[model samples]
Target: MSKLIWKALLASPAILGAAVVAASPASAQQVSSTTVPSVSALEATGDGSTLSNLDQLNQYGREGRARRANSAEQVTSVSQLSDVQPTDWAFQALQSLVERYGCIAGYPDGTYKGNRAMTRYEFAAGLNACLDRIQELLVTNVADYATKADLEVLKKLQDMFKTELAALRGRVDTLEGRISYLEKTQFSTTTKLTGEAIMMLAGATSANLDDLGDAFSGNNGDDNQVVFQNRVRLNFNTSFSGKDLLITRLQVGNSKGFNGVAGETVLTNQVFGDTGNQFTLDTLQYQFPIGEKGRGYLMANAGVWDDISNTLNPYFEDYDGGRGSLSTFSQRSPIYRLGGGAGIGVKYDFSDNWQLSAGYLAGEAANPRSGDGVGEGGLFDGQFSAMAQLTYTNDAKTFGLGLTYNYSYFGEGEFGFDNAGFVSGFTGTLAANVLPQQDAVTSNSVGLQGYYQFSPKVALTGFVGYTGVDSKGGSFDDADIWYYALGLALPDLGKEGNLGGIFVGAQPYLTNIDGDDVKTDIPLQVEVFYKYAVNDWISITPGVIWQVNPNQDNDNDDVVIGTLRTTFVF
Candidate 1:
């Protein structure tokens, strides 16, 4: 035993060798010939008298010599010791000590034997060798000699937050696995779902209806009664490539009672019924890139002018039932309604601030024969409007101006005087002055629209439009109409997502009549509204519209309309 201790002490080749020898008493004898036992064995044997500090140090000396003789390969990483794995509870500590302090060495075969029994003697010998190495590093002024101090701090920190760290790691692993599974099992990879719902309570009051010799006046006694309406939409937006989009919309509504056909009511809503209380495919549009500077949209089914135009009237063209203007005329220029049907449109951006847009839409493209098809009486020959607009946006992008022109060809029975084109204040119905089959007209319309943001929360918007109609072979007189409006809007009023607006304007009215003695009355319209957002997903709007002369006739009574609308989005 003395010789083995002397051998291990000399092999250390450091000051620790002298300390080791001095610490052990020469009188102490070997406890047993058996190999040094593990820590658990020492506790189990409980031979405290034989297990002296001097005896243990001498044993460490023997083991250190044996360990050095057998291990030739130096291992710096736990991975280099092939048997070590992260699942082992002590693996992290062993790795830190080996990597950070360069204190651990493996057998020539690269095995750590981490589970092998270890005695206090062997542990002491291992610690002594590590101390020698550290001293060598400090003497050489190596950069990593203070790793032991850092490790002490890290050890205390790890212990202080061990439970939280473990839980966080577990959650991260769970999330990663769940994301992987969802990627494989989720719905369409290219399609996403979106939806909107609207509810409205509305009523209108008017004193009398005018008689115009067979013209439809929508003179109903219940026109002033309050009624409830509902509309819901589900849209699927799909993308095959990154830059293109195809939209499919399914909608249903109970909005049949609000049309102007009832009591000369202004068209206040866009989500009215095609098939009341029944679900239907409302819109199908595809938007794709045309080039680096152009983009285009194709309407395969139910399309509207708002889908094709930038809608210079930026205040309220959302098309949702409960939002935007309470009256249709206040939404945009009536020319937009000239071709509110299926069509294709394109816009080319000359730069960030300038663009040119054009489109053609056929109002009655689903019927055939001499009146309403895509053929002689269809999209090409039936009632259709071709429109173009040039727009300029200011540097701040808060102001814009758009100049628009539209040319529409109307067939004998396809064009109606009740359309939005003539819904303004003074444009009285011309149906009584001409025979349906004998009268076909062509209209040329021009519109100027502009909006400026005076401040972050306030804006001013206005538009002026003119349309002139010429008769083909009918005996009716030609007419010209004019309409204009200026509005003030406050966005994010009271709170975010809220809006308030006031508008003063005139609906379309006849300005001139040729070859006839028909008298036309010019009417004025005033409106005020406020929209309050209850939360991120819901909003409510209340509004009122007053018309000085309803139906563009002097004999008719004034009209007042009131609406309370609520909207939900998801």
Candidate 2:
């Protein structure tokens, strides 16, 4: 499948996993004093702007003072009580402060000690720092304090600390409260919820015209057939958490056919209770943070999992289209398999715009139960599967590209063989020759898919896949199958409320077998769909499906099956 096709085929949600966790609050940087020119040099230059431009000069002076004030406010070293080398003392003291009170930025690696000697200038500067911080705290708590009173307290604190232990303990107490308040108000509460649904209708017709002529006689017959199927499904999802820190989804749907045929007879005539019926538990998954900075998350799911295909629209079951192509990747050709399973995955961002993921799955293959006569179960015999993918995104263009590979390995399974009949319960030699045979089988598959976005509103998508089978006793040689698809999508078309867009796609497939009787051919598939968003809780999708080849029989013309479908998501 192509990237445009995938985005056009299914509704996608923004991924908010580890990306949120890895983000950190922006920090303020210190303005170094070295960048400021000396006061004597400025005065000596006597720039004319100094006096006539005193106002502008005053603004610069005020900015410089503010920078100095900021530095002074955080300085809390107590050099007077130390007797160690200045550099060593400063490093150790800074480390100790960070460890004890969690105050003052410590050494780059984090360490601190108290055995530091004090210098008059250093002591004066440190004491002034404590006083500055004390004023800042007072302003935060007592916003209405008179200017005179505020200044008086500031001066008193500076005078006392400068002569005492060269630090103001009372001022430290006040600063802690301001830091606590800032932390408390740093984050705001926000929530977001998104939902989608689809409804569809389709019709199909098949015609076979043939003629026969012989030297002596001629005979011929013409067959024309039409089949109609209708299905409706509804899926619902609800999620809540800060920036997707936590997520939950729920899905449900029901489907039924209007007019159809199971085999050679009219499906409506089948006395069965429900000739065409289907239901699904589409998706249920949870995502949560795994490490600091939310570099990634741990995701788990239990429900109908969509195959990792590159195409915009899936090949197996178009929940929105009643009649869609059955994926060869599934157990068989005629049925859409839906089963339960559990799996874990991790998505990590290697850079601002790139990410990768790996996941594993284990459970019953979503095909008919093994032991059935259908040849479908050969590849799904209690198998295990794994997948890896990498993606690159450009936020400015709302575009992304991805590459993926998937593999599955099945355990030993039975293989069946058909033989010309002799009779039941016949003699040993004759019986062995008459009855059909069965044996164990194993199979494997590999696939590659890619996606590209042309713009935020449009995308191109497609993918190719291959599978191989191995059997015991050489009853049959290995067989290979391949599929390719391309599609286009229009997002938020017409900007209608709750309405997504429509998409059309086509896929072609081919298969070959290396055995006593060789066979090869290609099948053509097409689909057209309209998706409508009813609201936050529901979306409707209606679509059509056309298969140009039901069987690879070159002697027979193509057969087409029509279907009508509807899906709702909450």
Candidate 3:
């Protein structure tokens, strides 16, 4: 009876599994980034024929093959899923498949993500993978197999889907024609364009301007007015070899941003600009493989440590502000605020669980007058930051640790310390603003950052950073700065595409200088934010930031900032 059923199913245009899996293109479904080749490797070949349609299938097949090759661990029971419970309606079925049939598999992180929807192509690929596993199982146990009656039922189901499969086949045929046409007419075979736009409404409040006597006090008006700003970015990514990438980015924004309403640098989003909304070429970088386990990058234009460093601040590292923490200080350590210009960086993966990275960047690699430029006073002669870091993690990537060291040198008037020097930058404009004594300063900074995800929904992340700067060749004093933060993140909060975060930490505050202990009146930053994904291409985020002493002075009023930001991406 099973043999008869199998025969009936086999006679259908396509089996039930095939009908379920072969209706759409595999490219339409999301796949693991590690299991597929680069986009350049999968570019369309200019072949205008029925076979063009098969190219997409071939790509999916390659991904499937990659997955199979890497899937060496066979799960024997659903109990292995730490998050799944017996209360689930499908728990028994899933257990049966894993323990009895060995067809289902979970991620290395021990997640099933059972609620994730799959397209026909993805389904097909999964089915094929399971069938291959079953084949191996049957070879090992010839006596245990689907009964004759079960085969007959499968045959009947296949026949029932015969009409649907035929219609799908017709659609596939038409898709082949369309694919061929697109291949022949598509622009730039090696480049793609992607863009993002953000619109934000923000306002700030300060209450202590009436009692200050300093030269810089009361300069910021009492106008607690709301402001509107927009930022636009266009990214051009290209590849000649599949293993290399070239990036060119264009950006423009008109936000007063963090320029402090009254001569201060307050908390603001990374995307906020202080350039009065002038368009600029923001980034020019090329990343290419150095070896099987090594990679290197070169930045010919705008770049920063954020472009090259393995910033361990995971929950708050969104420079785009469309994701993660909203405050720039919350994003990562100020130690990584190295200025950009011509630079080189490299990384090596010693093993699957450990890696090392190093980089150098010059803030002024191109000023050809006399004291600066990429030549005389450039990468090696002028302002620069050199950094190295080591990181370790398990295969699941649920926990990670990173240790980093950076040495920075800044010439006179080149004090680009990512504002870690709160009052340092403003002193030159103060009552006795003496031009900073025209000295060269060197800073040694160290940072330790780590994160642990207890589960998919919750995680803890934090970092501690310290920098000691010494003035050399001038009459200036030495200063030590410290900053740290601990944050709790709840992802998929209230909905699948939402996130909630709260963190409290100190921004870069001067602890000591010239053998004198600096008094910190209010040195903490408190922040909270919620991001709701409106859709695949849009998100709405509402955030608040409270700075106890924005300038580390009791005379200054506590600062409160609120923002409603909307982001669009494509």
Candidate 4:
């Protein structure tokens, strides 16, 4: 085939994959980044036609073909990817593709690590993005390029290069058909809908279920029978400026969680339950640009640090969705969960690999009345936490590092420690099991976390954190808490889009008071799970969770929970 003919065929590869993996576009540079070569700049004339401006894709090799939708600004230069370097073997060879098509395909977390493989589903997503750009160009830019001189050039080529013209037009016809398919299959022009539903069949076995706190505060000798529960979330993501997003999420179902598992709230949904049929607004946030190097977020409700920063655990942290780890403690650093609810945050990238994130959230931002409770502290004085973080990712994107700090204050009677600070209502009783004894409290927490991707198929993530507590108006002088965890992820383990993961960590647990020991045991947690994608909208996961000591009490017996979880995404 002629070079031009070869170029035309490259478009096909971008569409062959059947998966729909969500691609992460470079966010910080969205407002004013470079773009691919334009069709009006190069020539694609037949033998007799005069040379004209053509797209830069012609400069790239066969393997460099790729593109994504412009919903976010596409990276137009290899330098923008940061992870790709000239020293790499494929660097120069892939530059043309990266310069024109957004890193030639990136992971869901926006990393374009070298030589990783792609699943069929993920490739399909690329195809959709390719179709979007191609259709957009054919419908708009091509017509504007049709000058009288250009037509005569084409006429001469059509007559002299009949065979090549025939083949070229044939490819165009195929593309036209694909474009039609795209038009017919689009979700919407202004708004897109995504949703997840998780159903879990679970049961626990423990030597004794007594002395647990919070929901499972008193389980004398009751048998932890098998139970079934579910959680569902629907997200309506709307974008008007292409670079900005308005997110509205709705949640329903019982999240009260398993009966035998006291205070071990792994999932964010573990907070409430037995709602019958009431649907609550789970998240309401707006993400937009701040100048050129910053992205900003305004969260009216249900906001956490994950809303505006990179968590660095793509496989293990699915934003608290059912697709990732089975427990909250394993998903991300407890520091990220410091405070949730109304907040404002921003992420600014100083260079390709370094970013600084800062935010403040108040657990009680709704109620005007003072005192303690959820969403009652107004904006500043209520239960709140302020956060700042500095992070770095390698040029290859295979490694990352972050240093995080959280400063928080909780009111007299508030209880959502694993969430905000020095309170006790969620997670392992030992982790968040403090603060009610005091009239009010303040905390200073520091955390270090990062991840290393060995390849497309395997990755490891680890983190350690510490929170120092000070009594505001209570009997205790000071307290100390600590936690750490490590997780391994194997993607596409048994089949495409399938994942197997294992994690072992200490849930944040109290260790001392006023330089003296507090009666608490190590809150060790071990969790293992595998998710097998049944198709585009469904997946099944089977997992086990073991708690060495519940409620920070060495006297309490260990508890193990085995569960089969099914998830639906759309």
Candidate 5:
């Protein structure tokens, strides 16, 4: 027999007499009113050492009760027992159960411990007593089945009890099975064992594939290039108790010359051949829940993350469907930059519909310097960034709003600056003169985005962003850029198991450097894409993109570009 069953047997009143010892006189007197049968009556032998089994003891108790009911026996000898104090919670639970299940309650004894802890053995005994009382109630509440005419009702009642017992046993079995499985199961999956990985691949190609033949309008020629970036991710999760889980993720990625402007190229010379891609540890972190509903969570990650515009822009094409544009916009919001770092964040779900999260990142906002001379670090050293986001979701739709701010102090170092007039390995005198000094450049940005669903298959998305850079004593006029976009999404595409959508966007800028020399020119972009689900673990996307004011060259007209891409996910 199992240890639990053996313990249950040893603790039974048949073996351990009902009145083994007594508490204080006052406490004993308080419980003396209840008429409890002597342990001797329930024993199989006179010495009380040779105890009866569970069934035998239960039958003896029932026979005694039956005899009293039939013969109206009175003046039964009552055995007094010491009152054992119970923990506050346990006593409360017991009282609640007694009221709810109509069980026999203890006498009016003011011995509720409220603090006395019970051992596992004692707890098992108390639970078994409660179960026995429940069984008795079940037997009594059911209609009597002692006659031939009541046989059908008796059988039905037996079936009902059997079903209930089966359900209870199934629950117990499930818990035991879970424990056994945990003991034997390995923590790592096959993919992890073989070092196979899953990655989030995203990038934007802003090339002047069709320049419309206008190349010389401004000093900064047509900016055109292709960018490919991917974030490799691996996660491990385990649970000590089934209710609580711990999750850890390792993230790594590479970006090929990532600058804010579309088609802006860096590191013209690819010294590493095709490996000139930007490398970064996007996210390495751990998360765990602290509450029953997982309402509270603790998370920490060290690596680079997407921080950019507040709305979905062609410049940031990551994620597919279900708030894809919204997530993408937030990733590229000017107030944000992806780089190496460590961060700690906490999230709390106020209810089913509301949540809040806050976090801080400590590290550089730009890529770290590499041996290729193209990469540079320490731009935002000794400076950290902070962000807070709020989300509200329901069955039909979800809305999220966030704010991010970053401040960097560069005492005396050569930081990177974008020279608007530099193009094609050429730097003009004006661009060189406008280059921002180390102590002058300080960046700040803010953005807002939202999504609304009109129906199951159709939804609207939009976002707006503003960014400013302060050159303490430089020639730049604290460059400010603003963007706004809206798109329509079709969730399902016929029976092909595909998703496709179209979007229209515009970005208008206001600069103080050129005054009337530079007009408020609006750049427009249009995109259409179709995604094919090749299988459970792979997908492909083919799309086309067109820009009206390419490179913000209003005088040069529009330019268009197209691409075909495929993805594999595990």
Candidate 6:
């Protein structure tokens, strides 16, 4: 009789799984609240010391019902399961349990779910349902299990695990009480709130007075003074369906870019901008799955291309948040910033390693009356950008590459490249973006981005792009814009959660304008910074930027910027 019970214990795993141990990560219906045991660890037990699986079984051993309703039904025969097949490797073991003790149950959907991951509580629920049937089987057919004397040995088995079973019951009771208290006090069951705050002390100046020609030798605005600035963001994330998400964000800031100065191109701090310290709605986006392999996005406001697609540069891109690079140009390709406000996008996964994405956004989409003017709305008639991209990433995601194409259009008047094409508030320098007044502009751009991780602690990322701009509805001739960047990242530089980085790139510059000699030299930027995570809620990043030919003119002086930034997240 002892041998029979020991054999059941030894063979429990065969009934527990072969496919269960091999289930894919995608099969998890919900994220585990606690760390899950590794597959190898679950496979073999050299000793009975590891009680995780045993605890799982006994968690509901005393209860007559399962945690889920459908899991409580009886499985008198193996044929009752639709997914189980005669060819399955575990078929014989499963049949033995079903025909002998009739102790088995399927998932709520009436499937055995052998390829899905479940928590300890879920496994316990299934095991408890089987235990209930075992009790019934023993009462109805004692002759099959043991004689009358063997029945007394069952009492000894129960006594042997008394303390262990009692401890398991105590844990389950504690968990239930904690869950009840949380439900009574939670802010919202469907929504979660998070926030980030940043403060910076910064200064910028020309590298030398002698290098600056008379064209920019004097009248450097108040950009020279060291100043303090800050920005704060509050995010509310809601989910009605477990697979979908709705995001709403609010922001306020008091920082104005040094671009207001004479020789600067892009802002040194990506998170700081000219907000006048007035709080405003920053983002509203809803995302949900479409069938199985597709996803759709609806951005009502402040939406950019990267929001709908993954930036190939994994460690470098931060979704324009406070954790990564300090400058806007270093965050991602300028093509992603061509036009942004309201937009829609769709993405499909061709395979685990390949993806296709397409999206459109209009910068001036809020206006009701259209015709190349601000405060006038037209979903397709005004300033807009459309893009398509195909990307590939290896299974480990250590190597990634992407190819993208973009078409952007902007009418004259209050629109047309944000600053007469001399510079872009999003990215690029004055020399690269030149559009004559009252002239509409249209551009076709192609770009490629890639990254490789050759070492455990180091990685390399590179991006290059070209944009051909044509003057529409006006007199200016066509032009060309070119840019490239290379980056080196040192993860966990000094400690965990810390990053040290170096980037060298030419923030978009003009190569040709109506065949006119636009610039004699490249407008290059080199940056280095280290972000030190002080804790879960705080970090300090100090960095400097050096720009050659600061104003896109080779004759002008180089510029240097220094900044120390602190961030808090919660």
Better of 2 and 5 by TM-score: 5
Instruction: Report the CA-based lDDT of candidate 4 relative to the real structure.
Output: 0.64
**Candidate 5: global Cα-lDDT?**
0.38
Evaluate residue 479 in candidate 1 and report its C-alpha lDDT on the 0 to 100 scale.
68
User: Among all windows of ten consecutive residues in candidate 5, which has the lowest summed lDDT?
Assistant: 420-429
Residue 215 CA displacement from its true place in model 4, Å: 17
Q: For this target, which candidate reaches the highest TM-score against the unseen true structure?
A: 6
User: 78, model 6: CA deviation in Å?
Assistant: 26
lDDT of 1: 0.60
- Model 1, range 42-94, lDDT digits (tens) per residue? 33444334335334434423332333335556655654443334564445555
Q: What tens-digit string does per-residue lDDT give for candidate 5 at 262-306?
A: 332222111011223434232344545657433233333343223
User: Worst ten-residue run, lDDT, model 1?
Assistant: 420-429
Return whichever of 2 and 4 wins on lDDT: 4
**Residue 310 lDDT in candidate 4:** 81
Cα deviation in Å at residue 66, candidate 5?
Answer: 40
Which residues of candidate 6, in runs, are more than 4 Å off?
1-188, 206-222, 259-265, 268-272, 375-377, 413-424, 514-520
Per-candidate TM-scores read 0.65, 0.44, 0.63, 0.65, 0.49, 0.66
Better by TM-score, candidate 6 or 1: 6
Instruction: Pick out the ten consecutive residues of candidate 4 with the lowest summed lDDT.
Output: 15-24
lDDT of 3: 0.60
* Residue lDDT tens for model 3, 1-570: 122322332233233233223322352232122222211222222233435444443443332222222333545355654333456533443455446556666553333432122122332222233344444544464555433322233333333323322233434457668988989997657898988888888887754544332422324455566888788888999988888999998888886544332323333433335446677887899999988999999998866676776777666677535567777667777667644467899999999989999888876676544563122365567777788989998799989888989888776645544422212332111111111435667788899988898899898889888877787865546766777889888889998878899988876666554422234443577889999999888989899988776555556577788988888988
| Model 4 ranges off by over 4 Å | 1-189, 206-223, 259-262, 268-272, 372-375, 420-424, 514-518
